[model samples]
Target: MDGQVNRVPDGGFGWVIVAAVAIINMTNQSILSVFGQLFGGELRRMNEDTFTAALITNLNSLALNFSGLFIGPAIKSFKPRNVAICGCLFVSLGLLICSMATESWHFIVGYSFFVGFGLGLISPSTFMAINSYFSSKRGRAVGVSLAGAGVGQVFMPHVVRYFLDNYDFQIAVLAMAMVSLTGIFGAMFLKPLNPPLQHNNRKHIRLLSEKDVEKCQVTPQAETVHQPSEESFSKKMLSRLVQALDLELLKDFVFWSIIVGMALVYTATINFTMIFPSFLRHSVDLNSQLVATCMSVVAFADIICRLLLPCLTDYLRIPYRVVFLLGTLGLFVARMFLAETKDLRVIIAMSVLTGMMKSATVINNNLTISSHCRSEKLAGGLGLSMMSKGLIVITVGQLLGWIRDYFDSYVICLYAQSVILFLVVIVWSPEIYYRYRRQKRTTTKSIETTIEAGVEEVAKLNA
Candidate 1:
């Protein structure tokens, strides 16, 4: 929303963007979350040990992450939608292969590596590509895009559950394969805001030579057509990455505060989203379908927040920092209350509040990050922020799971998470006032410069 426009706004078939991203996000995320359910079942059927099963899942997570470093470049090089379509193809193929897998290594190599690799390529590309269409309303745009993940979370388990119940595990994998392949068709429709920068160095050289021959001599016009040198290309890449990330933001205090706060928020957020279904089922005797539906309700609530909050933000002129604080606080209270009660209603209530709170934090953080970014650096900065959060999520999610196992209950873990959020707020409180002071100083300098310019103009007139 901060930079460019996608043809046809949200009212038209732009809604397709939401559907496409939702399918992609859902399939990408289910690689870990929904697959966690299949781990034990497949291991048992194959008579393999738990370690081998765990290895498969771990490999998937690792592949999903490290592959991003390269795949992100591919998206920029070609186009996001094309890359996403290819990624979906791989995901679909990998899933189909996984369905026929007969050994532990089959999944370790097939499902974990290949499928995960495809997702790492597709997921972030779609998110970054979609942003070109909604600069001023990027929060809502990102929300719509990210809501796909929520929708995936909502349905994947139930889809898995249906297969596990009605069919066998293999059929379920086939269904996922079909779903991911459908994602390929959806990705085909994505129109990137920026034209892919062509790098046809050899082609450029040939054109220069042809131009020279046509003129019967070397000419300055032909020289202009010569391919840029390799060194120049490398420099261009470095510059592009830097511009994409908006490295100028490192000079601003608020940016650092946001990075730290967002990381803390990620710690709490990933654990809850991943753990909630299992926690509820264990305590409340709900079916996976019910859990999926309940989570969908949360996703819908979150969608509302994503849509409404930005409109409210612009109208109220409220600082996004305050919005961040409020969202974090809501999450803290939800977690604390959740820990205190076993009543199903209470848990459901916590889920609703948690959804809105998480939504708020995301919407505000995105807006702030965009504010810090220069136009050129938008994609790179967003990727950097996401990379940071992704790393933190992997680390903290594992730690929380360990802590929960140690305590035999999730309550203490939630309490510790609440305390962490509280500390994050306290430490970062100065960021708000920092922005306030910078704005005042800028305004004062502009006023003084204007007055001086007016006096000089009058002196010239009098002379």
Candidate 2:
């Protein structure tokens, strides 16, 4: 596309967007996604229905995942900042309304729908914007950007813990509303970019017969920024969606292997933070501040992982596929240690290690998709992966909640989770090697083609 600013500014406003978006995302993500863990006490107070209380989280998650489908194309259509601003409005209002809800359904329909709707605005566009704004530093920038979620993981629990302990759930909801509004304003700074998405349609010109590039002479103009009209994707979009997702992905042994591996391990690991707080409240006789402090420790650990792991990947000479398999090993140790739980020190260690390992999971999966797919469609492919991962998290959330309630011991769920993580670790090993070899071969062939092309040019000159 024309008029794209793909390079990161040396040291000016681009860095500012990173900080601003980070705060906005941290606040917004905490407000919407982690409500289950944070507001457990509040939801129970209002509804006396853990299931319905949880529905608020579940529905929000479903909407968050579903919105990815629409948000991708929207990136090309609307300016990134506009999409972000719209999302902020949806979430800020959702939180404010939740403070007034008298019933579970009110919270669900209002809080979940609107908040999910808002986050939908923010989530998909966040990475795409950073990718546009920052060129050389994308992985680090994205790592830093998405690390906002872990930042939320670090503080929001304690924030929720504080309000629940002191004032009431309404105050907590209202405070988070204020936090969400920050994102609304932050979205103002996002100047959209036309990223260099390589068009593969040359071989499929028949599919896009409406436009003739050779005759058209694409004039560098502002019109390029406008999104296509309402019916833009109306023709064959369903097929394109299917083809883009490429469920044949599931058929490929590596794809299925990676999906199952990521899903099971991630599903098991997602709930440790939520459950750990309750476990502390139950086992240790600790006050809310102590619990929040401990949670903060885990959050800091997550921040370290987010920062360190990306640097590790970049400098690491090994194939990332192998690194991903090795990385999941951290989860196994973390889970098993938590299950033992003979002492508080062990508990803390397990929590920190889990945070570190989960951060690796985030980086590895992005690496996985980046390696497999073409650059242009990577975002959409990633969206589909998120859709699957989100669904897995929802099921795991409910299951973890059930396990916590049923066994009355967080360790049991922790142990069960360890088993799943390890199973995935074992399953992913061979597949990781397969992908490593495939990419290696592909690289070798591309190098050979370049060498041959140069040789042919030399031969023709000699003739």
Candidate 3:
């Protein structure tokens, strides 16, 4: 026990890591929201159709999500702080380059490709840093860190709108690039609990003493530990790369289930935000100011719910899966009502409800996924989910655009979202129920066996 390292500090420097990651997320979300709001105006400026503009935004999202695929390797090979710094630079460079763009293709290449990749690099690193520091209050830390998006959402529209109104698009973009540079400062502080291990194919199995059993469990932290290489250069490098990708996760059914379910949840919640400003303008004929106001309402509501719901869940001892399901149900109801509402007030109310559901779901998403696997598998599971979500975005992007383009109604788009959400819930709910029942039965049998074994031991001692 003398030389053993305590795994998680649970507080102290961990909260500092949380703050730094929160700032990174806040800036990233702000940039994303600004781009979403600018889609229509930029399309008009470039003389491009809505479909083309939507494709670009979807691609941007796809890049951002897909970047997670590389994060596992990046973190393994580089320090989290170094990777984060590189990510911030990529984001800043992307935005700066986009300011010089004169064509639709330029925007796609600059904003979608560069910025999205930068985001992909930063996203996992943020959560991983938080995870390194906090174990006991991880749920709370996740909620607080992600709430940065809400904070960004609350004010970023007005800031971006002011810049768009007062200056040319190029100047506005330039200002955003300048704003993004601050993220580098945040990234600088993202020190991990310890230097993560270099990637190795060998597994670590610690033989715990009976007294230490309650204090520590088997973990994949060796994924974080680095040792001197003992193999040929090419073979060692190849093994590290393979270890970083963690491709073996593809065999997991539970992992697939969580990813598919998350894809559906994302399609219903965050994806809607990317396209909602266009919906308000096209369907309801709302002015830019009003549209921004509605978006802000959603942001404000999301912040409030995110701040409160996680704490409440902890106090009430609610299961993460149950809360996540309830959140999805709320999102479905909100979307259904949103499709039918004509009044601005009703739409705004539904937006607020949507935000609350999104917040609740986001808070629990990581927990739900991690529950399905060992601690070491968490990074791989998240990467797989991100890759799956990106693929789903590519397919769904066209459908969403077609609904708006051919149908000429945002209501249809909202309806499409509600249906997708409903179907996912229907399909996944049975799995959750069956798994719950099986776990409960297994637990009961274990208890019975333990009791019988205890009785036999007592009889032997008396004899």
TM-score of each: 0.74, 0.75, 0.82
What is the per-residue lDDT of model 3 for residues 1-463, given as tens digits with 9 covering 90 to 100? 0111256777898888888888888887568867756545776877888667766777788998898787666676676788788888888899888888878888888888988888878877777777777654666788888888778876777778888899878888887887777888888889877756644322211221222343334355642343223344446455455556776777878677778888878866655876688888887889999997888788888888887887788667667777888888889999888777769989899989988998888888866765565545566666777888888877775577568669877788888888888887887789888988998999999999999999999999999
Ranking by lDDT: 3, 1, 2
Better of 1 and 3 by lDDT: 3
Q: Which residue pairs clash within candidate 3?
A: 196-224, 197-224, 197-225, 197-226, 198-226
Give the Cα error of residue 9 in candidate 3, in Å: 3.1
Best by TM-score: 3
Pairs in steric clash, model 2: none
**Which runs of model 1 end up more than 4 angstroms from their true locations?**
1-19, 26-33, 36-40, 47-59, 156-158, 161-166, 197-260, 277-300, 307-311, 314-325, 342-345, 362-368, 444-463
lDDT of 2 by residue, 290-365 (tens): 7877777777777787777766666654445565666688878876766666577776777677667777776566
Instruction: Supply the TM-score for candidate 1.
Output: 0.74
Q: Candidate 1 at 273: error in angstroms?
A: 3.0
Worst 10 residues of 3 by lDDT: 202-211
Q: Give the worst 10-residue stretch by lDDT in candidate 1.
A: 1-10
How does residue 299 of candidate 3 score in lDDT? 81
